[model samples]
Target: EELNMDLFSNCMDTVERCLRDAKMDKSSVHDIVLVGGSTRILKVQQLLKDLFNGKELCKSINPDEAVAYGAA
Candidate 1:
């Protein structure tokens, strides 16, 4: 329970920082595309949904294969 909370908190903090650094508001972000293994975590998905104000997330791409696709 504690570990999940910590992960969610950290992910929230990181996303907030990224938005700040980019001078972008959460409202300005229309789409959220998640990649990589860590994004498979349920907490992370929930965190993203909450952060983006329940905007639909794109999960069409296979998370595990994302890195390979990027390289290709």
Candidate 2:
């Protein structure tokens, strides 16, 4: 539980920082695209859903394949 909490906290921090850097508010974010394997964690997903006020997260692309897809 501790580890999950830490990961969730880190994820929230990163997302918050990104939003701030983009000079946007959470309400302005239309979608949440989670890449990389870490996004598979339930804790991470729950945190994001809560942060986005229950907005559905976009996970259409396989997390493991994201890097290759982006590079192509």
> Tens digit of lDDT per residue, candidate 2, span 1-72?
685687679879999999999999999998787788888988888899999999999899888888888899
Relative to the unseen true structure, what is the Cα RMSD of model 1?
Answer: 1.6
- Candidate 1's C-alpha runs over 4 A off are 67-72
lDDT of 1 at 48: 92
Mind sharing the TM-score for model 2?
A: 0.84
Q: What is the lDDT of residue 46 in candidate 2?
A: 84
Error of 2 at 9 (Å): 0.7
